[model samples]
Target: MPGGRLSRPDRQRIAALLADGLGYSEIARELGRPTSTISREVARNGGPGDYQADRAHRATEQRARRTKTSQLPTATTVVEPGYGRNPQAAQDFQEQLAALMVQTGMPRMAARVLSCLFTTDAGSLTSADLVERLRVSPASISNAIGYLEGLELIHREPDPGRRREKYVIYDDVWLRTWQVSARQNAMWADTAELGVEVFGAETPAGVRLEEMRQFIGRLSEDMAGGPTEAAINDALTVTAALIHAGRPRSTAELATALDWPDERVTRALRDADYTPDLIDPIALRRTESGAYAIDVRPERLSDVQRAALRDS
Candidate 1:
C-alpha cells in the first residue's frame, strides 16, 4: 500500500507483536502487511526501538535500508529490477513519492495512484492494476483516475481484448495541460463580460466588477494573440542560446528568434492573460532588451464565474 505509511505508533506496535513470539506471517496477517514486510521489519531494527514506539519505528526504517543494501549483489545488472518485485524498496519508494506529491498540493489517494502509475513502464494501468498497485479499493482508483483525467494528467483508453478501460498518460501531456489552462482562461473572460451586464456598467459596484472583468477579458485576448506554442518554444530556445552566448537583443536580434513582428509581441503582452488589473495596459509594455514580463497572474477567476448564475 500506497496509503500505508506506517506511523511511529504503528511501527512500535509491530515491534511489540514480534517480541511476543508472533511469526512473521502471523504478524503480517494481523497487521494487514505483506509477509515480507514483517520479516524485514524485525531483521532491520536490531530487534527493538528501546521500546519507544516512535523511536523504534524510525530506527526500524533506517535499519531496513541498511539491511537491504547488504542484500544487493556487488555487481550491477543490465536490468535493474521492477520495484514491486523488491517488496521493501517498492513500498518505501511508493510511500515517499506519494508523500512528496501530496506536499506539492496533490490529494493523498490521487498522489498515490499517480506515483504508482509513473513507476510502471506502461505509462498506463487498468483500474484493477491501480487497485492492486496501491492496495486501494476499486472505487478509490476510479475516483482518483477521474480527478487525474479532469486535470488532463491522464486519460482513459480502451483496453484491447479486455472489457475494462485503462488510464493512460499521454505523450504530449504537458502541451495538452497547457491548452486546458488556456481554454479555462478564455471561459473566464467571457464570464467577466457577462458580469458587466448583470451589474449595470454605470453603477459603482458594476464599475468595480467590470474593471475586474475587463482585466481578465484583455488577458484572454493577449494569450490568444501570443505566438503559437511551437513558435513560442523556438523563441525560448533562441533566447536561451542568446543568454549562453552573452549577446544583447536588437530588433534584428529577435527577428531571428521568431518570425513574429515587434507589434505582435507588444499586443501579446497587453493580452488579458498577462495583466489581471486591466487597469494599466502599460504593464504589458516591452523593455529595450526585447524581453516581456507580467507583474501579475493572468485573470482566471478562482471561484465559479458569478455571471453564470441567472437572476431569480
Candidate 2:
C-alpha cells in the first residue's frame, strides 16, 4: 500500500488525499496497495494530519544525507526496492517497516509483527496466523501481540462460532491512542502538583519538577476543569453516549462519568474505593451474560445503604 519510491506525482496525490481526510484504507484501495504500506509511509513520513509532500521530501533528503555521512558499505548492500512482488521483497519490506516502527516508539519485534499484518488480506490476524505469516515462533508472536495490545494499538476480538481470537485494528485506533496519552499526561500533571507541596519549589530539583507540573497542570486544566468544567463535562457526556450506545460498561466507564479524574479512577478502582463507581448506578448494571451493561438502571438505596455512604 504505502511503500516503494513514490514518484513526485504520487506524493502530491497522497498529500491531497490526506488533506481531504481520506483514511489509510481508502487511500490504499485507490492506489492498489496494502493498507500497511500506506500506514507505514504516513507514519514514517510525518503522519496523516501533519503530512506535507514538500516537508516529507525534505525529511527524506535529510535522512539520506545522514545515511551518506555514516558511509557504511552495508547500507548499499541492504538497500532494496521499496515494494516487492516476491517473497524476498516482502520480507525486505517487513524488515524496513519494522525499523521505521521502532522510530515511531514501537519495539523491533512488535513492529515486525504489526507490519506483517498490514500485508495480509484479512483485517484481523490470529496468533497462529502471525506465526505462520512472519515465520516466527508461536511464543514470539504471542509476546509481540501482548505488548501491542497493552499499548491499545490493537485489540483481541473473539472469533464468531469459534474458540480462537484475532487481533484487530480499528479506524479509531489513533483517536483512542491519543486519549490514552492525554489521560496519562493528566495523571502525571496531577502528581506533580502534589509534589510541589511535599517538595518545596524553592529547591532546584523541586523547582524543575514543579515547572513540569505547572506545564502539565495548564494542559490538564485546558483539557478538563481548568478553564471550564462545563466544556469538559459536555465533551465527556457525548463520549459517554457513544460508549453506552455500543459496548458494555466496566469500571472504567463508571469512573469517567463520575468525573473522578484519571488518577483517582485507577486508585479508587484498585483500592475498592466505591466513591467513583457509586455516582451512576445504571453504569453498574450486568447483562444476562454477567457482563456489565450501561442502561437506565437506577438503584434505590435503603436507609442502611444511605447511612453507609454518608459515614464513608
Candidate 3:
C-alpha cells in the first residue's frame, strides 16, 4: 500500500504523530502508507522513542543522491528518473538503512556509504561514482571509504577498464562481521572470568561476573564456527593441571570442570602442545603414574602445595 516516496513534510507529520503516542500501524494509516514501511522507517530512525523529522529528512536526501547518481547524465547517457515514483521514497529508504547501520555502532558517514554499496545491484562503486551519487565533497567520500576499509567492511580494487579504484563488497561480508563479534565475546568472557576470581568466588559480584563469563563464553564458542587454536591451548592447560592432581579424569570430568563440551576436550588433548610451561614444578608435584595418557615427565616431586593452588 506504499505510494510515492515520503517528503520532508511527510517526515514532519510522522514525527508529530509519534510524539502523540500513536503506534506504527496508526501512523501508517494516517500517512496512507503500508504498515511495514512505517514500521521499518521508525525502527531505522532511532525507533519511536527518538525519531526526528529534520535528521531523517536529511538522511533521506543523502540516500537519494547516491541512487540517482547512476542517472546523472554522462556525456553519452541521459539522466533517467528510475529510482522511485516520488524520487523522495528512495531517499527515505536510504536514510533508514544508514540509520539502522549507525544503530549497530557504525559511524554515520561510513554507514551511509556502506548502505549505498549494499543497496546497489552491482555491489561496487568508485570514488567518482560515490562523490557523484552522494553529492558530497570528495573528502567526505574518501574518509567514509577509509573508515569502512579499516573495519574490513569494504575493499578497494582496480577498475581495469576505467583505470580507477572502486570499492567492492565481499559476498561473505556477514561472516567477517561475525568473526569480529566472536573475538570480542572471547575477550569479554576472559575479563569477566578474571573478575570472578578477584572479587572472591563466594561474593555476589563474583557470582554475577561468573554469569557474564558463561554467557559470553558460549557466544564466543558459537560464533567461532569451530574450536580455535587459542581455545584448544587454554583447554589443554586446564586439563594438564587436573591430571597432575594425582588422578585420572574422564572426558566428562574435564568437560564439567571447564564448562566445555566433551568433544572439544578430546580434540584438544589429541593436538595439545605440551611444550608450553604452564605449571611451575617448584610449586607443584607431578601426577601419579598412569594418571595421564601422554607420558608427562614427572619432576620435582613434593607434597607441599602453594597457597594459590591449595583448596579449602
Candidate 4:
C-alpha cells in the first residue's frame, strides 16, 4: 500500500482527517502513505477546505484513464550492477529528498528538477529528457530550469550535434551556491548599514537596522570562511603571552610559553594580523629585534588623531 495508488477508502479517510483538522503529515501517518502523496491528493482535489472523497476519487479515475495511454516511462532509477539495490527504493528516496527540499522554501518544480538531475548517472538532463522523465509540460520544465540557473545551482551546455541544450549539475554546484549566498548576505548587510545611516542611529528603526547589519555582517564573514573560532582563540592566547612577557618575544619563545608548536604559533600570529577587529584598540607589531610585541596604540584612529598624538 505504501507505493500503490490510494484506494477509495484511503480517500475517504483523508477527507475525514481533513475535516478533523489533521495536517498532511498526520493524515499520511494515519493512512501509512508518504506525506507528499497526501499533500498532492489534497492539492489536486480542491485543497483541504473543499476536498471531497467521492469527487477526488472520480477525478483521479478520470485522470488515470486520460493519461494511461500517454504516460511516459520513468528512467530515473539508479541501477548499479551486482549492487543488490532496489530500483523502487532508490526512486522513492529521490522523491523524499525532493519533498524535503520543497519544505526548505524551494519551488516544488525546481526541487523535482534538481533532484532528478542529481540522481541521474550523467548529472545532466536535456529539456526533452526532463519532460519525459517528469511527465510535465515543457513550460514547467523551462521555468524550473530558469529558476535553478538563476541561483547558480545548474548550468546549460549545448547538446553535442543537436540543437537542444542540457542542464548540468557539477560537483562544485554546492560551492557555487554557497558563494552566491555569501554575496547576497553581504548585500543585505550593506543595505542594513545604509538604513542605519538614513534612519539615524538613535531612532528605534535605526537600532533595528544596526542589529541586522551586525548579525548579517558576521554571518557573511563566517560563510566566506574567514577566521574560525579556534584561530581567533589562538591569536588571543598569543597576544596574552606577549602582554605577560612585557616585552617583544620571538615565535619560538611564544610557542614554548604556550606549549604550542612553532608553526601553530606562527599561524596564530598571521590570523591575528588578518582579523584585528577581535582585539581592536591594541596592535600587534614586529619590533626591530624581529620579535612580536603588543602596541597599545589604536591603529584604526583617524589620520588627524594620529598626527595630534605624534605632535603631542
TM-scores for all candidates: the values are: 0.43, 0.42, 0.59, 0.56
**Per-residue lDDT of model 2, residues 183-220, tens digit only:** 77778976774665566656676677767865775565
Residue-by-residue lDDT tens digits, candidate 3, 1-312: 658888888899999999999988899899999988787777556566668989877866766676577457673443323334544566457667777777677777787788778767677889888787666889999999988887687998899799899999877877877887788887897788578767865689977986787677766767876556676566566556565654566556667777878777654543232222333332211122212333333454333543334653
Where model 2 places Cα greater than 4 Å from the true spot, the runs are: 1-93, 160-163, 218-312
Tens digit of lDDT per residue, candidate 4, span 227-301? 778988998889888889999999999989899999899768766654667667677876545578988666578
Question: What does the lDDT read for residue 178 in candidate 2?
Answer: 68
- For model 1 the local lDDT of residue 276 reads 28
RMSD of 1: 17.3
Decide which is better by TM-score, 3 or 4.
Answer: 3
> Which 10 consecutive residues of model 1 have the lowest summed lDDT?
279-288
For model 2, give the 10-residue run with minimal summed lDDT: 268-277
Return the top candidate by TM-score. 3
Candidate 1, residue 148: how far the Cα is off, in Å: 3.0
Candidate lDDT values, in order:
0.60, 0.61, 0.69, 0.79
Estimate the overall C-alpha local distance difference test score of candidate 3. Answer: 0.69
Q: Best candidate per lDDT, number?
A: 4
Candidate 2, overall lDDT?
0.61
- In the range 5-58, model 1's lDDT, one tens digit per residue, is 567766767877867867778877777878776555544333322234665476
* Backbone clash count for every predicted candidate, in the order shown: 7, 4, 1, 0
Ranking by lDDT: 4, 3, 2, 1
